[model samples]
Target: MALPTNHSLLLPALLKGSKTSINPSFTISPKSPLTISETFSRLKKQRKVGFIPYITAGDPDLCTTEKALRLLSSCGADLIEVGLPYPDPILDGPVIQASTIRALTNGVNFQAIISMLGKVVPELSCPIILFSYYNQIMKINQESFMSALNYGGIQGLIVPDLPFEDIGSLKKRANKKNIDLVLLAAPTTSNYRLKAIVDASDGFLYLVSTTGVTGARSNLNSQVQFRLEELKKETSKPIAVGFGISKPEHVKQLSIWGANGVIVGSAIVKLLGESKSSEEGLRLVETFTKSLTSALP
Candidate 1:
């Protein structure tokens, strides 16, 4: 299939422009929260392509995470994916796994991350999306976790390890809390499973660029464009590609491939970890984020 020349056709609802806040009033209530569609709809009106950057909460420390969140929002991130540190992160690559290990060693856990979010989310302009594994969600009572997310002002959730075939209960629970359960689709996904994942995804479909774990790569797979086109036919919902995405060129190419958004994880996480200090780390993230956003079509 030939790609659309007009980028607006990629995801018109996201490119059009409206109010982008998940909840404009800043009310802390998951029961009556803003939908992901509303936030994307607002960005659509502004004709801005979404830029999602991931970070491991408390990797360096909670204070650094706080500063990073503020800097990321001010720089260019449309939505921030905060990775909740877990003991076994099978889906994460070396960069992310190392960051999580650092976070965990520092005594960072889901509850601590939520506490940090509660303080930082109110200050951020973009929505906070908690990324975690299924085991952690199950470890805590589901309802309680939802309540904490609500109280923290989070608008989205992404469980990469949750199989699409078995996400029914988790999806339902997140829906009840008015939180978007963002699902992932991989290059290796079957037609049947791809359709299910696309339909179930709330905020945007996270299309993994390759079959392997998440990490930065110099070149995205050659089949990425074809795979994105195939996923597009499955659903009109916003599609954001992740895994192996790093440089501005990757963002540009993916945008041309009809991606509504781009998710950069390892690259950002590595930058944060490599920084000499909190201020330097925030600056590194800020500069890199700006470059990625500027590359969006």
Candidate 2:
């Protein structure tokens, strides 16, 4: 019996004769698509918790912000969240609030941040996530904002004021540009609200560790562990606990409670404010980042 005329009988014979017989000239390689969720999950599986260091862009100066980010990357930061200074940052605490004010006073605006990122993105090793409010994003026009973000090499976005109900347009735009729109889940969120947020969020979920504004707390809220446990039961996506995660012990506890990453913001911002010089500021950031990374289980 012979194979059908339409079938390539010679191809199967060639493939069986030698491993590379199919096509010696061409390589058969598989390319895997990278997604934000997959990247965060891989970090979680390594038993290495992610260290997300947040800093206000142009706080003190844009040059210092660039230097601090590079230092954080070198010190083991998995992702760096650059806060875009907003006139009213409701979710921020006194430290971040002060930092935002300073950044604004230094003339940091939407265009300035985009320009700074354009200059610094090429040098950063870790993923850069922009932390901004909806008003700022709206001011830039969604299309322009997305275009600038993509060009600036920003991997993800965190808009604290963007509600699930208002996420459709942004989500569509972000998904089109392959940008992850990370949604926040606060301690006060109801189960129904959490489910909605999880469904809409991409990359990793930002689980606010406390009920109030972002800041450094003496201890991790006991409710945080419970909330994380509940969230884990609900969604398979990686949950990065933020908002009040300051100390190494807090990072450890978050890891134990099944958090995929721990974000330290106010603590890092506070350190930057305390350091007298840019070099010293970067060193302090590196030291603090190392401590947090080392504390992860």
Candidate 3:
């Protein structure tokens, strides 16, 4: 099935530019939470797995990053993950690490990143999730970070480095704002830890397909299927598998394994790096985004 047109879901204020400000005193609807399972179900009915592509914010430059995001959303993304540039991104592979370095070099700090998003969010069709390390969040006052994210129209957050034991304060803040806080469950995670992480997670459970950093791999681990099965039995929330998922075949396999979503990052960023200009980069990403998403089922 073809993806739904944005006309049905685009915010009215976005169309007229009349709603320039997000009402600070406004309250979120209790039913407005964007859950992983809900997103997966919506995609499943369309015979597709959610395509969540990640790109470092301000990579190359903020303009390119924004263009890439708009392009991805226009082409076929169900959701977009904007990686906050961090100095020490341990979980990221060389490609992402280099992208982060470039972004930081271009003066992409937390405030700048959020400010950019505030300008672009009103125009976006797909939901935007901020992917960052805990330290980046810690550097700013917690309340301030949450306020900025809310103001920027962020739907969710993913902090790969945050441990289950250390999520209380963050969870409370996220819950208060009605923003989903997605937690990652790695292959190395024990069952006890998995339950804890899932219990704390609000939007969806991000299952890292491997034990290490994020990068493209020749093949996915066969064990990822079993892991998905186990996780399915534990929670009704959608399970999105990332880490080393770089190819169309991986996406197909993930769907067959009952995964609700597939996240492709390094491969997409690598393509962007190869393009000569931001416009060319966006075109390339759009083409690939449609191709990979079309192969999901």
| TM-score computed on alpha carbons, candidate 2 | 0.86
Model 2 clashing residue pairs (backbone): none
Q: For residues 150-169, could you state the per-residue lDDT of candidate 3 as single tens digits?
A: 76678888988887888889
Return the TM-score for candidate 1, rounded to 2 decimals.
0.87
Off by over 4 Å in 3: 1-38
Tell me the whole-model lDDT of each prediction, alpha carbons only: 0.78, 0.77, 0.78
**Model 3 — which ten-residue stretch has the worst lDDT?**
2-11
- Report how far off residue 23 is in candidate 1 (Å): 22
TM-scores vs. true structure, each candidate: 0.87, 0.86, 0.87
lDDT score at residue 252, model 1, on the 0-100 scale: 94
- State the lDDT at 244 in candidate 2: 85
Off by over 4 Å in 2: 1-35
lDDT for 99 in candidate 2 is 90
What tens digits encode model 1's per-residue C-alpha lDDT throughout 231-274?
77767788888999999999999988888889999999998986
Considering TM-score, which of the candidate structures 2 and 3 is the better prediction for this target?
A: 3
Q: Sort by TM-score, best first: what order?
A: 1, 3, 2
lDDT-based ranking = 1, 3, 2
